[model samples]
Target: MAAYTGPGRDTLSDVLDWAVVRGGAPSVAVQVQDGDGTWFDAAGTADAATGEARAPGERLHLGGISQAYTAATVLSLEAEGRLSLDDTVERWLPGALAGNGYDGSRVTVRHLLSHTSGLFSTGMALEVQRRYGTRAAFREHRYDVWRREDVLRLAVSEPPAGAPGERFWYSTGGYAFAAAIVEAATGNSFESEVDRAVVRPLGLTHTFVRHRADPGYWGPHPRLHSKMFFRDGVRPEDVTPDNWPSLLEDPALPPLDTTKANTSWAWGAANVVAPLDELIVFMDALITGDLLPEAQHRAMWATESTKGAHWLAHTAYGLGVYELTLSDGRTLRGCTGASTGAHALVLGTPDGRRTLAAHVANDYSGFPVFDRLLEAEFGAPGFAYDR
Candidate 1:
């Protein structure tokens, strides 16, 4: 629980300092666990206004990492024989994906979990883009609440990304639909289902879901910051692809404090929050087969190639997790979550012997540092930088 001065401690500190001093992050916190023990470290400020330092165990939005929890819940349901991975969307939520050229019967729970359902993301809808895509729109509508039905309707308003299982289209709408299916199959809220499946079983004291109406963190946490610049004279439409780089580098502007923004738009799919340490435990349990039955656990890590999916570099999509390949050609299982101003990642070896979890108070750009940090800790080259 003290400052890490073990192997690679200096290298980790250098990267952490770089992230805050030059990488534009307000703060960065990282925790790593292995056979020796657990180590935690932080750099930069937790609150920009207060100049408070970031610390380990500080709760932050889990972002896309919530998909792993949702995935676990659905798999547990399958383990109970209440549902099947191959169950069609229509089997549970009868006509939800029927419109927008989507055949609900053609999409299965597995497809949704693996981002292969081909459902167009509600977050990518033109209307959504016009309203919340840019910093200006975000500032203006940060507090707006979106209902579950509203998100579903927005999703089907667009055409399918591809036929089910044909392409890897990363869609939060897919997870939302999966959450809806979980509700129909269990007759319970997604949060309760996650609690039953992931939280309670793993004894995670700090992890919980963020409801649509809630726009704040539950306990002590760092202030989330984002680089979605919102200048006074500029409109959302004005920040185009060609000029965003220049705008991002303008040192005169401060990052936006998105800590208070409502995340209902991607609720259920990316709403879970927890401290970094608890996240490591949950991820390790999930990876080590402590949370699901043998067959289901195997299925959870049965990652397929994301050749055509909107995936990260050196990563492939699993049921609700990611299989990240390192430079050594070894792969690890993990998940990533991001809210407006925060980004989080949980990565571990397949056997769960070693794990690393990190949170950044800036946008996802802070992720590249993980590659170096991982190598420094685990003795393997990471994907972020070449040695």
Candidate 2:
């Protein structure tokens, strides 16, 4: 593990400066820490229509980043000897292996966290979801199961994309498979295991692995929200209320849906959601020796970074989180999230310096502004927004 002692700490006042300059109406919160002192700022509005500014410690989804937390719990269980990291699936869940090509035996814990476990398919954003933003909307209007077995079954019917560790691939389904492994090994659901191992110990009060509680609104056109994938923006459009391009051509060896005109499905890959502060605390725990024992923490970041859609300045992956070397040579281990009108980036040095930053809106304006906020806090010059 890299013990990073960050120098010349940045303050939250700098972040507020950038936010005041570039932030339009989107709500944003930023907190940056050094060894002794910390700086914090919350700006903009929480609700766009009402112009309600967000208070400190507001909630937002962490997206697939929760997988990193889930991965840690699985690894912890392995350390306790409840199950070996190399254990196979058939030994635990017998009949669950229906049509999926995933051999629980072949899919190791090492494979799951590092996204080496070649699961069935990369989940897709369905058409109904494209029209409706939130996962709740998907369930209300459409009948999508978004099950772990669905993709596992999809893989069971197919062949492995390649042998585990052959290359780098990002699949939430792989985490789903790993979650299943956790369930089979401990006889507890992934949600329960996470709540037990990670959330409770790390003291993440706002971290939620399950779905968000929806405010009841029966209008024909309700607000769309997605709890996964932050790409161009965290707009309702970015929520994949419809099919995304990457979801179409997955390596799961799809016997069907080879056609590009298919819909997206919810899977374990993109379900976890959380707030920015909780994410910051979780990252702090990973750095301060609350999450991993010590040796496991070292092992989690053992592999070298290869080609993937994303990587952090290219170090390695122990499990789910990416190891990124910052411009100042500090290792920032965390994830980026964009779902519906929400965006998240939780970053910190292994020593103690941490920053929890995020924005939530029903539009796309929040992203660039957040980037500019990061720039100001990180000592980068130039205002991000042209306006």
Candidate 3:
């Protein structure tokens, strides 16, 4: 009922502080809900220059986690008889994936949601990486707007990762096609569909689409930071997890403030923003069948193997969500999201009786802080935090 006033809630603050003080995050916020009640806490500075403490209410970027919402919207359309998961991308958007060794006729809606479509990630293209992947490139194109067609074109121009349904290949470009299919089927923008199916229905006041023209958060939020900036001749691929710890401590590349960058390049894939508590409610409603019908809800967790996805250890990909096997071997479902300067994770039990939501205001991927936090909440030994 009160912030940090529930069972096992007392230690969350320490974990958050550890993330900031030791894990190289500028700020971290976390919220948990269970039979004991709800608890909230935050640590580190929201604005490093001002030494402002992080607040539990700050709106944080959801990043790729937004794909879950988009996927839910697609499922809602299916529930309404507007489309089917088996429907080929070609069925709705003719010739959208016909070029560059792609055959949309074989790429189904399910393939896109489960990351088995084998489509190349436009966001990971060399051109995009050179333009916006690193801190130096980000500064150059911070305000540039990338149209949907422009982004998708880069995907098809590259060779496919493999045949459709061959294996897990994470791709934001695939979600772009999914969003286009949504519009093609409903004759409405993907954002509008999400509002109708998830946002408005759940009364999520803090959550909304991050428009291309809007280059910053609408209200109070942490000043996002990243250590992705490196000296010239350093490639994005060189920033590996093995070196990330040292990089975080590297004096030459102190965290760069990336708070004001445009997110239009990730529109349908990673554009939602919400505070931790609202995100918890959204994820809970999703798995608990509050936002979906029985059949669709069942379909949400019908997971596909993530063997080659290089995702979290002991995990599998599902429709708009992930099936994570914890240290104790208990399965939980949720999504992890990241962008230039923010990261978030939301996971809950199938019954929706327990949930954990966390946000870090630095752009490091798959940090150990989340693993420690999950262990504290679930009474587990630990999770496989390795990337």
- lDDT tens digits by residue: candidate 1, 192-242: 999998899889888898877887777889988776553444444455433
RMSD in order of candidates: 3.1, 9.1, 2.7
- From the highest TM-score down, the ranking of the candidates is 3, 1, 2
Q: Which candidate gets the maximum TM-score versus the true structure?
A: 3
**Which of the two, 1 or 3, has more TM-score?**
3
Stretches of model 3 off by over 4 angstroms after superposition: 234-252, 380-387
What is the clash count for each candidate, in the order shown?
4, 25, 0
Q: On a 0 to 1 TM-score scale, where does candidate 1 land against the true structure?
A: 0.91
The global C-alpha lDDT for each of the candidates, from Candidate 1 onward, is 0.80, 0.53, 0.80
lDDT for position 267 in model 3: 64
Q: Rank the candidates by lDDT, best first.
A: 3, 1, 2
User: Tens digit of lDDT per residue, candidate 2, span 204-291?
Assistant: 6766565312221111111222333223223433433133534332222211101011121333344554555567777777656677
lDDT of 3 by residue, 294-330 (tens): 8998888888777645456778888889888866678
